[model samples]
Structures are given as C-alpha cells and as structure tokens.
Target chain A: MRSVATNSTARPDAIDERILEELRMEPRATSKALGLKLSMTEVAVASRIRAMEAKGILRVVAQLEFRAAGYNILALIDVMVADRKINEVAEALSRIDRVGSVTMMLGDPPIIVQVQAADSADLHDLIVNHIAMIPGVEQVETNLIIDIAKWRTGSAQLHPTSLPG
Target chain B: MLVDDVDLAIVKELQKNGRSSNREVARVLGVSEGTIRQRLKKLEAAKAMRLGLVTDATALGQTAAAYVRIKARPRHARAIAAKIADFPSCSFVGLTVGRFDIVAFISATSRDELVRVVDAEIAVMEGVLQLDVREPVGYAKHRFDLIHIP
Candidate 1:
C-alpha cells in the first residue's frame, strides 16, 4: 500500500479545479466532454487528470449508496489507548478493513478510529472481538449515529472568478 | 443494466422517491408492472441500481460526526487507510484530490468523544499530518443520481 507524504500539499491549479468541479457533479463525465466544456484539448484534460490521480490528488471511485447496501447502522467508536502502546493498539485496529479511518490524537491514551459496519453485530465484532484483542487498548466507546442532517463532498467552490450553473 | 428509455424513466422516478413501488414507478414512467420487474432485475444483475434503506442518524442518538482528512508519509497512505478501515468507528475512507491524502467520516456519541478521537488517535498516528476535521452543522439534502443510459 502506497502512503501519501505526511506533509504533502496539493494546490489544484485553475484548470484542475475546474475539471474536479465538473467531475464532482458528474462522476461519469468523460474527459473529451469535460475538455469541451472547459474549452481545452481532450488530450490535455486527460493527461492532467491522469497525472493528478497518479499523484494521489484525484480518485474515481464508485460511490455506493449506503442505505441501499444494507448497512443501516453508523457508529463512531472513541478509543483510549495506553500511551506507550498507542501505536501497537492502533496498528492492530488498522488491520480491520471495516474500520474506515484511524487517527492518532496528540493526547494521553491517544488514538481514535472511525468504523462502519453492517449493523450492531458487525460493530460488536470489531469493538469487542477484534479491537479489545489488541494489547494496550485501554477503552473503547461506541456511539451510534442517529441523524446526519447534512453531508457535503468536494471543494466549497471550484471557481472564485465566476460561477457555473 | 442495458437500460432502455423506459428503464431510465423508472430509475429517475425512484431517484425522486426510493419508496415508490413497482406499480407506482411503472405508473409514473408510463410502463407496465412487468416491465418494471424485468428492468429492476436486470439493473440489479448488472450492478447498475442498488436498493437501500434510509434512517435519521440523530433519532438513533448517534450524533456528532465529522470527516477527518489525514495525509500520511508518501509510502504510508495505502497501508494507513487499510489499517484505519478495521475499526468500528470508520464510515468511509478514500484517497482524495486535496491537501489531505485520505479522508474518512467518524461519528461520536458526544463532543467529548469527538475530542478524544481527534486529539488522541489522529494526532499520534505515525506518517499522519495536515489533519483537517469538520463537523457538519446541517445536512440539507441527499440524493442518488441515476445513470444516464446511452
């Protein structure tokens, strides 16, 4: 698995930002079509995009609808770890594919993970069976999400010069 | 799915109202119930359309969620993402087109837990930097787009 540079910075160029905006609205937008919209050559658009993705700045993934996938439960698990063993515990939890994100805190007994599974049973298996099994894991708290009033993806605005509608 | 115009119409209707029944969908799309069934089956088989159940996250008492974007050492992003995906708290993970290399959604029971997650776990993870966490104040609308059949 390739990892991004810990301190890497990505500043999307003007054209790159425009391309991203179009793709955000239509993930399936073709490079030729996008280039036409932006008044750029198809080869230019495609090459730039390919480079962006290769640099880990862009990813084209199938955004599956959550509810339709039979995953009706969303929970956030707060984890406290033994300070010295924080990495040990976190590395262990990271091995679980079901856990979506793992982040280490700059605090005592640090490390927290974001997990999503099928339901209560799946969540339990992770927290109870898998997470607890890792040595140096001090505590794990589960919080099931009830309402997500709003969720947004992508940039706030693709262009500041002018709005495209 | 090899969608015809009629099938596309059915999908459009459902995207508007997921709970719509086959009969209702057919009525809205000006098609027959049998046609709806066949199209739906084909779509499912082709992995074009997926059916899902929706619920309110707040009603369930699992409130306070945020997206944590983490940038790991160049050689560490994929391994880090794989490791993070194992926890029960992660909702989704993706390598993205932004300052951060990986992004994920995490929900907590309370603000305190949210802090624990950010300050404790995320900050200490090796090869992680540029951590940007944002909590959504309100969710305006959510929709699934239909595939445009050629």
Candidate 2:
C-alpha cells in the first residue's frame, strides 16, 4: 500500500497568516493580484504560496455553489450504524453519487451525513433507496434545511480579531 | 439600543439576501432605505453579521474533501490544534469530548493528494496518538440552520 509520509510539523508566521487570509476570501485570485494586495512581488507571492502548500498551511480550491449549480434541496441526515459496520457504511456512502459530505459524529449513533440534491425526490431516492441499502446502516433521520445562517469552508471562518458581540 | 421587531425583520431579510440593495430590502421590509443602511452598518460594526461567499470545490479541481479525526496527548491538545489549523486542509477543527480529541476537514484534487494529506501531513502533527479519516460522499445539508429573527 502507498502511504504518504507526514513529518516536521511547525506553526505558522505572520506572512503565512496574510497569505491564508487572501486565499480564504478569494481562492482563485492570481498570484500577481495577491502580491499586489500584500505588497509583495508576484514571484515572491507564488513561492510563498507554493511553500505553504508544501507545508500544508495553504490549499487553493474551487468550492461549488450547490444551490446555484441546480441542487436545491438540502438536508442533514443523522444515521445510527452498527458500531462494527461504521467503516463499511461510510465506504458505501462514499460511492453514492451526489453525497456531498458524510461526517461520522462523535455522539449518539456515531455518524452524521450531509447531502445535497436537486429536489425532495432526488433526496428521497438517494437516502431511502440507496443509502439505506448499505448493510451496516441501522437507522437514519434527516433534517431538511429551511434557511442558512452561516456557511463557509474552513479558511473563511478564520478572523484574527474577535467578531462584534 | 436593543434590536426591536423592525430591526429583527431587517436582519432576517439581510440574512437571506446579503447583497440586496438597501433600497430594495427597505421596499420589501417596509422600512426607509436609510434605516436599512444604518442597521447593516451597525451589524457589521458590532460583528453580529457577515457576508458569506460560497463556491464550488469540484469546479476548482478539488475533487476530494474529507474529515480527519485525531486523538492526541491531552496536554498537547491546544498546541497541536493550533498547528493543525494552520494547514489549509484543516477546515473545521474543534476540541471535542468524544472518541477523537480533534476533527479537521481536508480538500484534495485527486486520490494522490488525499493520500498525501493523510499520510504526509496529518500523520505528522505533534502529539497525535491516532488518526481516523473519512471521506464525505454526499452532503445532505450543511447550511446555517437559523430560523428565529431575534
């Protein structure tokens, strides 16, 4: 089996903080644009970014606007899987189409699954028909989202200063 | 001043349509445009509200995203968490009272990158005792579930 090596973990510095902040706001921003904003040369910005990526401090990704992409129905499903079959069920879920995020929870049934679909019918088919078919899945409960208060990926959540209380 | 019914109505509308112009929101909420502007500015200043930008990771070549749970030395939990959070892959990290001490989300463009993240990056965090990782196959719902205006 091919396994990646992990070693030499270290903390981040001020420059790292600035670079991460820029990427968080706009992941697709060009190195030159980022450089202009940070007052660093484009080459410098590029190298710093690459270094961070290498160090695992920064990752540039394209995040989908699922709703805009035509997936309208959103639901949070909590599943109670047989303790022994959690891995099996999780692997099965990973194979299902349009399964956005399958999170194994810490408390209770021990798994929380998040799914996005085109409509209620699509959601129904995925969960009732497909997900439930997995051998280890014992029980499932879903909460359909009515509104979104705060939602963003990891980087976007970081704010150096405290938010107004 | 405490937020009253009118202010609450304005907040609810803004939460739904963050970029809606003050004039437009005012028309919908039956408030003056100036009132909308003042409330919004106050919200930002008070840190009670923020504008969010959502994107597509798959469109940007991030084909893989997963959550990794790590059990670490209790004494080194905070230090390890701070270090792990520095990684871009560490999307959501929290000190949990469960089987795992820390949880993080990682994004990768391919199988190789995902493996690299698990093997080379997360495995090396100081004081980590054990690691369990899971890849999310689908998202049922991961939005902010806010209903009450107050």
Which prediction has the highest TM-score against the true structure? 2
TM-score of model 1 vs. true structure: 0.49
CA error at residue A131 for candidate 1, angstroms: 1.0
* Model 1 bad stretches (over 4 Å): A1-7, A151-165, B1-150
- Provide the overall lDDT of each model, using Cα atoms, as 2-decimal numbers: 0.57, 0.59
Give one digit per residue, the lDDT tens place, for model 2 in A41-101.
9998877766654444444432323453356665656678874557567667756666655
Q: On residues B51-108, what C-alpha lDDT tens digit does candidate 2 reach at each position?
A: 4433234324466766666789999777766676666665455555456666656777
Docking class of 1: incorrect
Q: Which run of 10 residues does model 1 chain B get worst, by summed lDDT?
A: B141-150
Count clashing pairs, candidate 1.
Answer: 48
* Best candidate, lDDT: 2
Model 2: lDDT equals 0.59
lDDT of 1 by residue, A125-147 (tens): 87888877777777876655543
Which parts of model 2 are misplaced by more than 4 Å?
A: A1-78, A82-165, B1-8, B144-150
